[model samples]
Target: MNYWLIKSEPSTYSWDDLVKLGSDHWDGVRNFKARNNIKAMKVGDLCLFYHSVNEKSIVGIAKVVKEYYKDPTTDDHRWYVMDVEPVRKLKRPITLAEVKAEPRLNDMQLVKYSRLSVQSVKEDEFGIILEMSEQ
Candidate 1:
């Protein structure tokens, strides 16, 4: 399955909020690249639920439960969203600082595209991040 990193500002929509809701449509993407990443998602794909803004860390895991559909929050037909449900919270959040310090993660999109709200994660990168969380 494909892996992704999905960011949300804790104040607006934290990992806790997602855990509480059980499942929610991931929407509000405005950038074309980020939109395309959303469109690429498939059912059973895993996503690292990142808390951006003040808390720049991956706090939880989420699974794609549904494929792309027209974004319900907007009237624009160009945008789409997918349903995701919380899988589990990380043993410990993996901070941006930690990721940047690791040489293996230097080429990661999270390091290269800091401003991206949604980004692809290579399987190795995904495994590395998961390992980091355990420590």
Candidate 2:
């Protein structure tokens, strides 16, 4: 399965919010690239739930429950969304500082395209981040 990282402002939609809701549509992505990334997601793909802005950390894991479909939040046909459910909270959040410092994660899209809300993650990078969170 393909791995991904999806960012949200904790104040707007925290990890706790997702856990409480059970499963919800991941929408409101306006960026073309990010929207494409969302479209690329398939059911059962794993995603890292990241708190962007102030927190700037990956706080939990989520799994795609449904593939892309027309975004109910908007009338624009170009927009799309998917369903995701919280898998589990990490043992500890892996901060941006920690991610940037790790040489192995140097090539990550999280480092390369810091502003991208939805980004692809290499399998090895996904494994490394999970390892870091445990430590």
Per-model TM values vs. the true structure:
0.98, 0.98
lDDT of 1 at 51: 92
Q: Which segments of model 2 are wrong by more than 4 Å?
A: none
| Cand. 2 TM to true fold | 0.98
Each model's Cα RMSD: 0.6, 0.5
lDDT of 1 at 63: 99
lDDT, candidate 2, 1-135, per-residue tens: 999999999999999999999999998899999999999999999999999999999999999999999999999999999999999999999999999999999999999999999899999999999999888
Candidate 1 to truth, TM: 0.98
Q: 5-121 in candidate 1: lDDT tens per residue?
A: 999999998888989999999999998999999999999999999999898999999999999999999999999999999999999999999999999999999999999998999
Q: Quick one: how many clashes does candidate 1 have? A: 0
Worst 10 residues of 2 by lDDT: 23-32
